[model samples]
Target: MGGKQGPQHPRTPRRRFDIMSRYWTFLLVLVRVILPLKAEETSACPADCACLEPQHHILCSNASLTSVPSILAEGTLELRLDYNNLTSLDTGAFLGLSQLSALHLSYCGLRNIQPGTFEDLHSLEYLHLDNNLLESLEEGTFRNLSRLLYLHLENNKLTFLGPDVFQPMDKLSALYLSHNLLTELSNQTFNDLPQLRWLYLNNNLLSNISIKAFAGPRRLRKLSLEANNLTSVPRALRQASSLQSLRLSSNPIRQLGSFGRKLRSLTELYLDELGLQEVSSTSFAGMRRLRTLSLRGNQLEILSLPLLGAQTELLLSRNPWRCDCRLLWLYVHLQVMKSKVSQGEALCSTPTALAGQRLLNVELQKLTCPAFGSHLTTAAPYKVPTYSATTAKRTPPQVMETPKTTTRTTIVSLATKATQPPPVQHPVPASNAVPERWDPCLAELISKVAVRPKGEGALMVTWSTIGEHDQVEVRYSTGEAVQVLWVTGELAEVELNQLHMDTDYKVCIIPLSKHVAQCTNPNPTQCAMSHTSGWGGHIQPVHMQPTPSHSALGTGVAVAVLILVLVALVLAGAYKLRSRQAGFQRHFDEDGFESERYNPDPYKLDGVYESNEEDRKIFVTAASQWSTEDEDKLDCRLATSPTVLSTPRYVTL
Candidate 1:
């Protein structure tokens, strides 16, 4: 039940009838689980497969059918051998689909599967080997998929998945290895998937991911790694505290490693098209439940980053922004969150008479800069990443040598990053790389508490405050009362209520401003009490859970099998976290069957990039090329290559 699909612009017809009413209500749940048998000679329907009777499915897509026609009528239930060329699947390849439940071997040039080729599909549950040419997968190739719940090995050529390669997929919950060529992921590689909640290793070539490869998903909400080469921010995802969407767009991630101030159940983050030039006002420190951030095509100029998480909503379109005075405080914060803090129109590209205006329509007194010799430099303060799994110590990645002429910026024929492509420069890893202080808390730096369990004994404490913090104290003790609630102004969620039911308590969150600080550590604390206390930062202990009754018969069948596995994981993580989509980087722009030498990353780059354009649909329309005859065909190809363009360069992870 991993839903939240998003990305299909709203030209509205009820948003295209709500995506065809969610694909006809998930095809009437595969036509009520297929079954109408009893029709003669192997249910006759194989020549160029299209069997539709009682819709037991089977649309042998682009039928170059390399054999699977195996007299299949055990009520065949959905099998669409996509764009076929079936390289190899062999071994009983559906020897009578035991009621196959959706299986689309996508764009199949399928390069070998052969391991009990889907052990007689015991009612398989949506398994699409996306645009295949799989590289390696054995652990019994999803050994009889335990009611597999969506597992698409996106555009494969899977590099190496080995370790328990998704072993007995314990009810796999959406695991798409996006545009694969997976370079690494071993230790408990997606460990015994306990309903892995949507983990699409986006456009892979992943540089060794495995701080215990998500030591076995415990409802990992969404982790995309958009175009990987991650440089830090993976202290094993601090054991995924039920992580809630983290995409890391076009990675080459350098800094902002403030490991998102310990994820606190992050709310959709995707540092867009990474090539970011500057943005650290504690680059989203402790993401106070960040709500959709994506600095679109980056190279951001003068963006003193601080659209803090408390209510963040930005995409910032194709960034190359600039309007100076350090971006006039985001053009006066976009005139106080105008248009709820933008989705596009962040244009500007520097003073060639304000190149293309609209960094929030310039003029904050013409956002000045240039006090002297200024090709606009001064962007230093950012050494984020704070890795700590108990006393951090992650060495290697101390390249800090910028200030070398403010780190290379040789744009010749104006931007578009000289025809992008070459972001494999990892940098940012010498763990605990500080540099971010000053917190008289005017919001955007402190006070974040995240509890959950809102039933028996109650608790839903979701906070985030810092200054003028008039109220908000919440304290759980298990050994007593609601402890304390208070909560006022800028109220960031609260629910406390009584206590001690299935007791697991130990919560805390202070934020009451009157400049009271006196809890100077001495260990033990559910966030100290006698009220006002002397505080001394850096304490982190996190681990922020539930259930019930004095029963008989051995904890009442383990609490009725843990309340029917927590009511099927709270109804599939609360209907996909209440229908997620704080613009989840539009899941790399909703694939839309992207294949054609899979991802020919194009943004009209030339100077050097080798493509990775998010899910390159090669500019289908920016109004068919943003005017001036595409800038005079890119200034006649930079005046027939007059050289020296340079830009994308980073390397050091």
Candidate 2:
């Protein structure tokens, strides 16, 4: 029964939606048989068979075909059509070649390719179009090659790429678009290729990149955009979230600002040969994860804020990094991190303080204040000698010797200075002897003194308007009176000799009536008196010489002659000393005496000398005279040195 049923009817085959089934039966099978596409010898293939396939390669070497062989179609997986005379490729030229895996069209005369030229090469993996006259690519040109993994489009005149020219090759892994004229890239140009890893875009004219242009293919690891004119790190690279290594060694990035934020995933960042001077904070904020950072052959002055990140290895040699206080932090931190990091190259940039010093070997102590102790000492504020009453009046410093005495009054009134005693509180009426409220009585007296500039002797005094009666009296003294020469509102000077210099003046109050000038509120008289008389040095009246009697004149004349002779001797001695000192100076000036051996001899003293030169002259002159005297006459001769040879001495000149 089964045999009878099967004999008379034939059944139709069901449709297949499987891409492989449809493509294979409709395209591959027909292309393999009817096209008779095979080549045996590169030069002797049948006109119908594209070329005889020898070892599965249809080698149409040096083929003079102006167009591709129209009827040649087969399952030939590798096609070598090098040295061809083809100027252009038709979209459907290889329409039925489903098994073509490697296609080499190098050194061909191909000038242009239609949009769908290789759209039917579904199984093609490696396509080489190098050494061709191709200018550029149009969108959808390789639309059907979804499994293409290697695309070589180098050595061509491609100035730029159309936005979606490579959009169809979703599985492409390696691309060779180097040696082109691309200047910039658009965002999403590489968006869908999930399998791309190695991109060689070097040796091109790329200058900039869109921030999101590399936002695809999480596996993209090594990218080389070197040998291009880049003034900055590609913006697309900053957002290249999955990049592991980047090569931007040769560029014109003069400043490293936010430069490291881009390569968060970068293990190695090559920044060598860049023209950089300073690196700021954001340059390494994102590179806290970096393992190796190289900054060789750059123009850097110091390792500043940017280098304060955690890197396993850092290279900063061959750069001119100036080590200074500004670099103190980096200098010290580098040392502590040396043993922790590995394979790092750190070197010095200065040959003085930092000479031959590895950054890792320089400790913070070496840069501390102690290293420049002398400089610090010299720079510190110094203590200078200030003139105070206590200092100015100390033993009334030895007088400077001058030449002549004019009058007896000119003789300085000398006194044995006694140490002062602490102040004592006096009774109120006695203390009030010096009034506090501007002293109307005293003010009138000051007016009188102010009008007396024509008089030979005139005095004026002022006192502060505050303090208790006792404190006020003690504070104000005739000795502290400052004289106003021209009657200006402010006092000009304090004449210490105007009042008793060594006197302790006290006080008494007989009300305002005692003042030389009358007061508005006349109460009792008030006046000051000395607790001790002659408390200060005495003041002799200016007694211009008294007419000398005959006897006195004779005595005076003899004394004057003796004084003149002594002066002559002193002048001679001084001349001799000056000659000796001048001779010494000449020897010194002529280099006859070693300067180090010519230190001052403190034992050879010249009293009250004005300067080192004058002191030397006096010492030499006096010493020569003394050296000639006998021991018995030494005292008298020595005494003569200060008196006979001595210049005039004054207490206050």
By lDDT, who's the top model here?
1
RMSD, one per candidate, in order: 36.9, 40.0
The numbered model that scores best in TM-score is 2
TM-score of 2: 0.44
lDDT of 2: 0.56
Q: Mind giving the per-residue lDDT tens digits that candidate 2 earns over 1-653?
A: 99988955553233334655777688877776655533332434435335545556576767665777654446677777778777789879886778889887887867898888887788999998877767778888788889999988887878877778888778999888877788887876787777888887877888878877788766788787866778876667766667777777776776654552446566777788888877653365444346667788888766654223433356777777655445665665566466654343555565355665666666655553222111111111223334567657334233334434321111111131122221122232431132233343332212111111111222222332111111111112344431111111123221222444444432222111122122333222333333232423566656565565866988989999999999999999999899878867776777765553353555444422334555443322222222121222322232222221123121111
The lowest-lDDT stretch of 10 consecutive residues in candidate 2 is 466-475
lDDT of each: 0.62, 0.56
Q: Any runs in candidate 1 off by more than 4 Å, and if so which?
A: 1-93, 96-104, 108-119, 122-144, 147-150, 153-169, 177-193, 201-217, 225-245, 248-262, 265-269, 273-283, 287-301, 305-318, 321-464, 467-653
The TM-scores of all predictions, comma-separated, are 0.26, 0.44
List model 1 lDDT by residue over 37-114, tens digit each: 334544577887878878788687897887667766678788787887888887877777777898888777777786
